[model samples]
Target: MPEAGIEPDVVTYNTLIDGCVLTDDSAGAVALFNEMRGRGIAPSAVSYTTLMKAFASSGQPKLAHKVFDEMEKDPRVAVDRAAWNMLVEAYCRLGLLEAAKKVVDEGEGRAAGRGDGKYKRMYVELHSRMFTSRHASQARQDRRRERKRAAEAFKFWLGLPNSYYATDWRLQHDGNLT
Candidate 1:
């Protein structure tokens, strides 16, 4: 990275870290993280999330806790459900039922009650649903319009001269033919 003239930013670091984790290369992830810190690049929520996932998947809960602790110290760090879900699954896989339960409870608490948090979730959900519905309605209207246009085109085609069938007769039973 230092060799390249391109300076490493948070986005670049995050991508490198994600690739390391996907390949189960925890050591590489750690090295890149240290390099990031040395370069004075503050990790964002996405950075922490990727590190947390790497640590958890690599069976290195100790390192995961280190990242989590750092996250807690950084007041601006926003831990999303994906982060919590990673811990929850990790704990469950390790048969740490209590820890898994605690993580789950904490996530639920963050999204709990009929207060502002709940209202915010509700607003997000409602807004997304309404937006989806509007898109679907527009699609339906478009289909209807297309069908109408096709019907109109067929009518015009039928109305053209010499467009009729020469014989419009039904078959008769037995020897009788129409």
Candidate 2:
């Protein structure tokens, strides 16, 4: 669109990002998102959530969570239920029940339960599909490991790159690990 002298806005980026998801092109979605930001077109909640959807659909919960965290930190847009739900869905896609549950619990608890039972149905469905303690144990370990890594990321002397902490920290510290 820019080739035609048409300035792409947030909506344009969101639509293209969502298209990338439909095509299972998550890297393309990320590229478009970064390009959007690089061009100074501030991302809306829809832009963030759409990019998160691309990551979630591509089974990249880590990237989805990163987009979600950026959305929350963005002064231009408010983090709404759709953004929260996309994050929950990302964990669900990975069969990470504990992570999804944590996000679901937080979402449901927000605003004194305004969106009360929405996640209950989805969680029940996803849990029924698992029907084993195996996934539970694995998810528990993953959650713990994620938290420990996030906490330890504060050690600047370790010299981990910025990309490491920026993306990984969002999935930790849900009132359980400070």
Candidate 3:
């Protein structure tokens, strides 16, 4: 856009934000978003959704929620289920099962569009992430418990007073002990 002497607008920034998010560059996406706002470009749904997805995929669901909240307050930007699903998937990937389920439940209860086959696809993806996160978290917990038990055993041994004694012969001859 700069090369063509066409000033980059909100849409341009949004496109860049999507690219940055896809590449896992949430910071770059945020920077571009701020730059867009600084240039007095009113963000559209595209801008908001792109940023929301960026934050969600970056494991910052709170930030994504903030964007979604603002999107909801602004009548101009339509709140789409995809944005919600992005956040759901993010939370699921982080092992936040409740939050992920909340998103899904909200969508279902609120009559959020089925999006034809897209809703189910997103649901399956989110479910997969939840399972992966749960497995990974459980594995980590098991390893931690094992380490704690080993450490406790080591401590117990170290804390005991050191002593020595004869075995079989001393046991038989009680009078000749010491």
Candidate 4:
């Protein structure tokens, strides 16, 4: 039998927070976190990471970043690789590549010794995705430029009658399609 009237500790609360993440419940996670603190249960790194995951899964990077900032500010906690990874995941979920890159660089500096195989893999994957996205954006711009150039050429050609426009075509100023 369990001890009667035993209050939930950080570990128990963390499990609840993780459950919130699995169910895509950001608000519930936040509420549980607040309640845990209200009851003087010091949040561990896992607690923070799980709550951040809840927001990240819900596509709320701003909220996830807020949770990360709270975790970073907690003096009792030593920010870990998982926490850093979750922060990156939050930004990446929203396609915020620049923010994720900044976080990765910060991680490289702050958690350098803590970087494991997982962090290395994520770093490589993020860079590859960024490279692909950049190239894709560039290709789109190139196609758009080509299309604009073609349109301008057609407009120029339309303005000419055998390489020259009628003088009167340029003179029509009121309700003119020329």
Candidate 5:
């Protein structure tokens, strides 16, 4: 299209990216997204959603999360329910049910205030799929194990002798262990 003297706008780039995503060409979609940014075309919510979907479909939920984080940090980009839906889907696909549930809960709260039925409906669908998934059990087990490890580590740290803390404080503050 550029060769045809038809300058690609944000919509054109989004369409190309969507095509790349649909064809399972996530790398190509990313390249086009970068090219779009390089050309000073600001990506809309749809652009980010498309890229997130591509990353999700490619089994790179972490990448999708990174894209979602970027969208959240960019004030120029308006994050709508569609972006949230994609993120929830990505987390669900990665077996991160807790993370997906967190997103769904947050989306539900936001939707409640906006009176948007679409957001609520999407949240319900994703929540049901997440809980019913086989990965849900694994996710729960992993979270429990993580919490147990964290508590044990914390207890060990807290159980250290007061003398050790005093020595460390003396070394830093007085330049000598008392």
Candidate 6:
């Protein structure tokens, strides 16, 4: 594009970063991000959110957190509900429930003043995930208890006197031996 005298803008760079992230090339995305900044192109919320999502999908939630932190510190970037949602999702994907809950709480607090609905949705989703996890754990415990009960019943049947092994069935059927 540069060779054709077409200058890359923020949107162009963001698109390229999105492609890189989709291809699992976080390094490429970061390089493109830095290049955009070097070229005096300010990153938008979409840029940071894309980067955070890439890092999260790559199993690097800490890097995602760094991206979120950078977004927060940048005055030009508006950390919207979408950005917060990405950060919370990253934390949740890593099974950092406490961290995700913190994000949800912060989002709710901000939403209360701004009247935004996205933050409320984030809170609901996080709570749902927590509930699902707890329910799965309870199901596993119930299965274990069921297996224990079955084992105990089998043991009791084996210990019953005069049930099968304690009586000689052949002798009882025929009084005289052949």
Top model number, lDDT:
5
lDDT of 3 by residue, 120-159 (tens): 4644554344323345677776765555444444333223
lDDT of 3 at 47: 86
TM-score of each: 0.58, 0.61, 0.57, 0.60, 0.60, 0.62
Clashing pairs in 4: none
Residue by residue across 1-178, what tens digits does model 2's lDDT show? 7689988888888889989989999999989999999999888889889999999998989989998888878888999978987998899888997788788667667744665564456445443443444456877767655544443443321233433545433334565533
Residue clash pairs of candidate 2: none
What residue pairs clash in candidate 6, if any at all?
none
Tell me how many residue pairs clash in candidate 3: 0
Return model 4's CA RMSD, one decimal: 17.2
TM-score of candidate 3 to 2 decimals: 0.57
Candidate 1 vs candidate 5, lDDT winner: 5
Query: What TM-score quantifies how close candidate 4 is to the native fold?
Result: 0.60
lDDT of 4 at 101: 78
Between 4 and 5, whose lDDT is larger?
5
Query: Runs in model 4 with CA error above 4 Å?
Result: 1-3, 111-178
Q: Give the CA lDDT, 0 to 100, for residue 90 in model 5.
A: 93
Best by TM-score: 6
lDDT of all predictions, in order shown?
Answer: 0.70, 0.76, 0.71, 0.76, 0.78, 0.76
Q: RMSD in Å for candidate 3, one decimal?
A: 19.4
- TM-score attained by model 6: 0.62
